[model samples]
Target: MTAQDHHSTDLQRNLTNRHLQLIAIGGAIGTGLFMGSGKTISLAGPSILIIYMIIGTMVFFLMRALGEMLLSNLNYKSFVDMAYDLLGPGVGFYVGWTYWLGWVFVGMADLTAVVSYLTFWLPAGASFSPIDQALISAGCVIFLLLLNLLTVKLFGEVEFWFAIIKIVAIIALIIAGAYMVATHYTSPGGSVASISNIWSHGGMFPNGVNGFLAGFQIAIFAFIGVELVGTTAAETKDPTKNLPKAVNSIPVRVILFYVLSLVVVMSVTPWTEVKADRSPFVELFLMAGIPTAAVIMNLVVLSSVMSSMNSGIFSTSRMMFGLSRDAQAPKMMSFLTKSGVPANGLLFSCACIMGGSLLQYFVPNTIEAFTLAGTLCTILFISVWIIILLCYIRYRKSRPELHTASSFKMPGGVFMSYVVIIFFVFTIGILSLEDDTRRSLVVSPIWLLVLAIGYFGFYKPRIKNQNTPTKKF
Candidate 1:
C-alpha cells in the first residue's frame, strides 16, 4: 500500500503503554459500581462482595481468551475480526452489528446519566425540563465528537485523565473508610464504624440465597465493558507487551476497585444502613461528616459516566469502520480523515446516542428507559463474550500449532471455555428472575429478528450474487 492508501485504510498506532493501562482500568470500572452498588448491597448485604469476586474472576478469564486470540494473529483488529476468520461471514456480520448496538445502548444510558448528574448541581427545588435535558445531552455528544475527531491519541489522553479521576476517588474512599474503622468513628446516626459492620448486620446472608442471586443481575452489568481493551488492539503501540500487562492486572483491579472499595464502604456504614436510592460513596463521605460530599461525588461520578460514554463512542465507531471495510456496512463508514479518525462512523454513532436524550421527551420516565437500555446492553454483551469463547475453542482445534506456540494461551484451554459459558448461561437465567430484567429478556428477541431479516433477506443475497470473499483484515 502507498502512503496515502495506508493512511486511509489503517488506524494509527498512537496509544502507548500508559494509555492502554489506564484505558484497561477505566473499562473494568463502570458507573454501575459507583451508582448501582448501593442497591446491590441493599439486596444481598455482605454477600455482594462474594458476588463481585465471582463475576470478576469469570471476566478475567474471558479477557485472557480475548488477549490470546488478538496476539495469535496481529492482523485481527478486534474480536469481530476473530469471529469473521474463525467463524463464518454470517456470524461475523451478526457479531459486528450486535456489538455495535450494545455500545449504542450504553451510550444512551451514559447520555441520560450525564443529564441526571448535571441536575445535581441545580438549586434546591429547581429542575431541568425534558427540552432542557435533551439540549444538554446534545451538547455533550457534540463536545465528545469534536474531541474524538481530533486524533486517536487524543482519545487515549481523554480516557487517561478520566480514569485517573476515578482511581483517585476510589482510593480516597478506601483510605478514609479504613481510618474511620481504625478510629472507631461514630456517625450522627449513632452507628459506630468497625470491621464487624459487614457481617454483624445480618450474619453475611441477611437476604438469603435468593437475594444473593439477585445481586448478579446488576453486578454483571458493572463488568460489561471489561473487553474494551481488545477494541484498542489496532491502535495500541505494542500489543504483545501492553496487552498481557493489561490482562494480567484484571485480578488486582477487581480486588482494589470493586471488592476492596465495597468492603470499606460496608465496614464504615453497615450494609443495612446503605441507602438503595443513593450512592454509597457519597453516603460514606457524608457519614464521615464531609459537608461537600454530595458535590464531590457528583463530580466524580459524572466524570466516570463521561469516560464510559467516550469509550462507547470510540468502540462503536471503530467497529462500524471495521464492518464497513468488510462490506457488511455502508462504504461511507470506512472513510477516514487524514488523521486516521473514522469521522463518518463517529457522527453516525453520536446521532444514535442523541436518541437517548429524546427518550426524556417520549418515555417521560428516564430511570425506566435507562434500566431497559442497561438490561439489553447486559444481554448483548454476554452474548458477545460467549461468541468470543466459541472463537477461541475453534482456534485451539483448527490451529493447534498456534496454540502450542503461543505465549499467552488461555488457562485450562477448552475446558475453561466451557466452564465460563455455563457460568454465563446461569447468569442469564438469573436475569429472568427479576421483572425489569425479564421484560428486557422478552424484548431482546425483536432485535435478533431484525438482524435475521437484514442478513438472510438482504446481506446474504447481496454477497452471494457478488461471488466475492469478504476482505480479511
Candidate 2:
C-alpha cells in the first residue's frame, strides 16, 4: 500500500460499507435520468443513449482517479486535504470553497423540485400565488431540515431507501418495456413500436449533431456527484474494503441505469414522440395509455429530490468541516456532535436552503428559478472539477512516490487530467453562448475571485514563514 502518512490527518473514517454503497448508487442516478431524459431524447433522438454512455465513460475515470488519490495514503483526510498537501494551501482554499458552492447550487435546484412535486395536491394554477408557494416551500424545507438534523445513520438509512425506490422504478420500467417488446404489444395510439423505433425514426442522431451535443449538456450534470463517493470515505467504516466495491461497480451501473434504461424507453415509445418539457420515463407509461403514470412518476421524482437534498446536506457539511479544520472556514464548523456528525455545519447549510427557498417562491416560474440556480450549480461544480484536475497535476509532480504506488490510479496520468480540464473550460465557453446559462458563466468567476481575495485576505497572511511548517490539517 502507498504511504498514508503523507496526507490524511483530521478525517475520521466513520461511514459504513452500506453508507458508501447507497451514496455511490444515489450519485450515479440523478433526478435528470428520471425526469429530464426526454429532453435529451428529443435533442439527440435515440442517440441520447450514446451521449449518456460517452459521458459515463469519462466520469468513471474521474472517480477512479479521485479514489486512487484518496486511498494513496491514510494521512489524506479527503480530496481537499490532498490538494493542500500536493498543490499547496491556495489550491486547497479554492477547491474547498468551490466544492461547497457546487452542492449549494445543487441543493437549491433540488429544493425547487420538491416544491414542484408538491404541486400535485394543489389546483393547477395555485403555485402561481407567491404567498401560497412561500408557505409550502418553507414547510418542505423544514421537513428536509429535520431529516438532516437527525443522526447521520438516519440520513444514510433514508437515502438507502430513496435509492432503492429509484432503482426499483427503473427496474419495473425496464421489465415492463421488455415485456412489451417480447409480446410485440402495440401502443394504444395504434402505432406498432419496436426496438427498431430507436433507429428507424432518425437513425440515432435523427435530430442531428445539435441534438447530440445538447444531450451532453444534460448528461454532464447527471454525472455531478460522481466524486461524492470519496467524501464519505472518511466517515465510511471499512472504507478500504467497501470503497473498492462501490467505486469499481460504477461503470457497470452507469451503463445499466442510463444507457440500457434509455434504450428500453425509446424502444417502447419513439424518441420523437416522448415529451420534451417533462419526464420521458413517465411519459412512456402515459403514452402507453396508462392512466396512473403521472402519479407513479410523481413518487419517483419525489424520491429523487429527497435523495439529492439528503446528499446535499451530507456532502456540504463535510466540506465545511474540512474547510474549518484547515482554517478556510470558522472553527466552530470543525466541531462534531455526539454522533460524530458536524451538526452546526449541517444547520448552516439548511439555513441557506431556507433563504433560497424563500427567494424561489418569489421567482417568476419554477423552471425559471431552477434554470438560474442550476446554472450556478453547474458553474461551481465545473470549477470544483477543474481545481481537482489542477491539484492532480501538481500531485503527480510533488508526490511521485504516491503516484507510483497508488492503487486504482487515474488512467492517462497527468495528461488526461489536463485534457479534462480543457474540456471543462470549453463547457464554460459554451455556457457563455447560451442566454439561459450565460449569466451564471459571468457570476461563477466571482467565486474564484472571492477565493483569491480570501486567500490573500486571510489564510496567506497566516503562512508568513515558508520554512516553518504550518498546521497539517
Give the whole-model CA lDDT for all candidates, comma-separated: 0.87, 0.74
Error of 1 at 155 (Å): 0.1
Residue ranges of candidate 1 with Cα displaced over 4 Å: 1-7, 123-127, 364-366, 470-473
Error of 1 at 361 (Å): 2.9
lDDT of 2 by residue, 1-473 (tens): 43323323354565577777978999888866765576567767888887777777766666766777777775676788877787778877888888887887777777666666666656756654666666766676678778766667777788888889888888888888888888877878875658898899869788676666666655677777868887777777766678778888888888878988888888888877886556677667767887586579778978887788778878888899888876778877876765666767887877776666676767846655666777787777777777677777877887799788876688898888877788777766766545666776777768777888889977777656334376463
Instruction: Output candidate 2 Cα RMSD.
Output: 4.7
RMSD, one per candidate, in order: 2.0, 4.7
Residue pairs in clash, model 1: none
Give a tens-digit lDDT track for model 1, residues 124-215: 66778888878888888889999999999999999999999999999988888899899999988888999999899788889999999989
Against the true structure, candidate 1 has what lDDT? 0.87
RMSD of 1: 2.0
